[model samples]
Target: MKVVIVDDAPRVRDRVKALLHADAPYAEVVGEAGEAQAAIRLIRDMRPDVVILDLQLVGASGIKVLRAVKLAPHAPRVIMLTNLTDLEYQITCLEAGAEYFLDKSFGFERLADILRDLARKSGPDSEERAVL
Candidate 1:
């Protein structure tokens, strides 16, 4: 599955990329962006199957990017990975069309499993399953 990662922290981006490389071999990191506008542009241009988005960006909120892209004709599945663990933030992101809202500290490792499942469900030969 094609993947785009949008996060302000280089370390976090690198770690996520490395994790995907090691655990989710079916996932390819097609692009990376550190800010909101760039992320929106990259996601539009790349049209990746999945996007790992951060809640707080360099100069803008990830919610803005999420809202913008989710309106596209073929919107990608978005997983919000952020340090913000507040219930309000999670609800907002989910309501805004995020497939998953996860805390960066505790939920980081769950990303690969989610990606793998998505890949399996989206496989060309497999029966299509609804992803909510």
Candidate 2:
């Protein structure tokens, strides 16, 4: 599975990358971005299978990035990770087409499992499409 991570913090990106490498080795992290416009461009150019996005960014908000990604051609699956724990933010992100919305503090393990499942389903030998 091809993946892209978008976060304002370099450490968050690094941690997520490390998790992916350790738990989902088959998932190739194609690109990463710290802000919205660059993230949009990277997602468009890379067409990764999934995007792990932070809800905040350096410039434009992550929700804007999510909206842009949803509009892109062959839109990739989105997994939103945010420090914000507001129910409204979660609802809004989901309404905007995020496949999953998770709190950054508690979501890494779930993210790893999701990535592993995505990688498995996307593998050449797999014939089933992941339902979520």
Candidate 3:
């Protein structure tokens, strides 16, 4: 599974990459970005199967990035990984077409499980689409 990680913090990106390497080895991080515009451009260019995005970016919010890319042709399944665990933020991200909205503090490990499921579902023998 091709993946892209977007977070302003370098440490968060590194940790996520390490987690994927350790848990979801099938998930390949094709690219990463530290801010909204760069993320948008990288996501557009790489067309990854999944995107791990932060809710708060350097200059623009992840919502903006989500809105911009979620409707495009063959849009990737987006997982909103953020520190903001408020119900409103979760609701907004889900409404904006995020496949999953997770709290960074509590839901970090869940990301790997989600990715593993996704990888299995999208494996060569599976007939269903990956993003579904």
Stretches of candidate 2 exceeding 4 Å from the true structure: 119-132
TM-score of 3: 0.89
Candidate 3: the clashing residue pairs are none
Model 2: per-residue lDDT, tens digit, 57-128? 988999999999888657788888889868888878887778778888789888888766655555333333
Q: Candidate 2 — worst ten consecutive residues by lDDT sum? A: 123-132
Q: Report backbone clashes per prediction.
A: 0, 0, 0
Candidate 3, 57: how far from true, in Å? 0.5
The TM-scores, one per candidate, come to 0.90, 0.88, 0.89
Candidate 2 has an lDDT of: 0.83
Instruction: Please name the candidate that would achieve the greatest lDDT relative to the true structure.
Output: 1
Cα lDDT listed for each candidate: 0.86, 0.83, 0.84
Q: Please, what are the lDDT tens digits per residue for candidate 3 over residues 1-132? A: 899999999999999999999988889999999989999999999999889999889879999999988877878888889898788888788877787887788777898888876666653333232121
Structural RMSD, model 2:
4.1
Model 1 error, position 26 (Å):
0.5
Order the candidates by TM-score, highest first.
Answer: 1, 3, 2
Clashes of 3: 0
| Residue 8 in model 2: lDDT | 93
